[model samples]
Target: MNIEDLRDKDLQPQLDELIGSLTRMWATMLDCHRQQRAIIKLVSRSYNLKISFQSESQRQAALLLSVELRNLCSNFQNWMVAQVHETSEEEEEFQETCC
Candidate 1:
């Protein structure tokens, strides 16, 4: 129900597992993006035409979506690193206080 419950229940391992899963998922997303780009490039080269959004607004939207995805990934990485540091600090503090 609270911080004490989380600590007492020893949920760190589960949290760690979830983080690992998410990390894998993120990597897959990035791989998919790369594959999509490659496919698009291949198609465009094969056809000798630009393959892209049909309208200016659509192109802008796609650009924004890409920027957002990049920001999301950057923020997620930063958060994950901070979480690892926070967990280690908490463990150290708990050890100091309890033993």
Candidate 2:
């Protein structure tokens, strides 16, 4: 469909749904991160107790995965914010033109 066919009012509901989904996803990600951190702590403790090779390997892998997840979440948040800002600006412009 053409841009002219797309109206902000028509898209608002979908946008709201998307925003809601993103918000929920973000909250879930935060909870997961907290759980991951807790698990990492437990693993680290396990590593410290006996210094087993497998425990150390597991701890390192967990740490790397946690960092990767954190980075992904940060990037997703930044991208989401940019998308919302851009959509708002477009809506404003559309309104101005329509009026």
Candidate 3:
């Protein structure tokens, strides 16, 4: 569709694309999470490393954690939309039977 035509389009397809893109982005972070956990285990295994939340790296960890949280929220939204769309489609089919 032309740019002018696209402006008036509904957001269903856009949202679907968003869901696909977000899934890919979230998958990339899985390796990072695994590495982080491994780091924690390695540190704990070597010395009696005291875990403290007062570090700057902990703040960075919080930021990374938030990204995963956001992805969970996005996936929930997409699931909701897909359910709604399925319901609407079923309703349309039912209406056609009344004719």
Can you write out model 3's per-residue Cα lDDT over 29-73, one digit (the tens) per residue?
555655755765574475444455788999689668767765765
Candidate 1: worst-modelled 10 consecutive residues by lDDT? 40-49
Per-model lDDT? 0.69, 0.67, 0.63
Q: Whose TM-score is greatest here?
A: 1
**Model 2: per-residue Cα lDDT over 1-99, one tens digit each:** 766457455686786787678667766866775676577557646643543446878979877976886676577657656766776686688679756
Pairs of residues at least 3 apart in sequence or in different chains that clash in candidate 2:
none
Backbone atom clashes (below 3 Å) for every candidate: 0, 0, 0
Residue pairs with backbone atoms closer than 3 Å in model 1 (clashes) = none
TM-score of 2: 0.46
Candidate 1 per-residue lDDT over residues 1-99, each given as its tens digit? 999888667787777677678667766866776676576557446643455778999989977876786676567657656766776686688679756
TM-scores, each model vs. reference: 0.47, 0.46, 0.42
Q: Check candidate 3 and list the clashing pairs.
A: none
* Candidate 2 Cα misplacement greater than 4 A, ranges: 1-54
Candidate 2 lDDT score at position 23: 66
Alpha carbon lDDT of residue 25, candidate 3? 61
- List the candidates ranked by lDDT, beginning with the highest: 1, 2, 3
Q: Which portions of model 1 show Cα errors greater than 4 Å?
A: 1-51
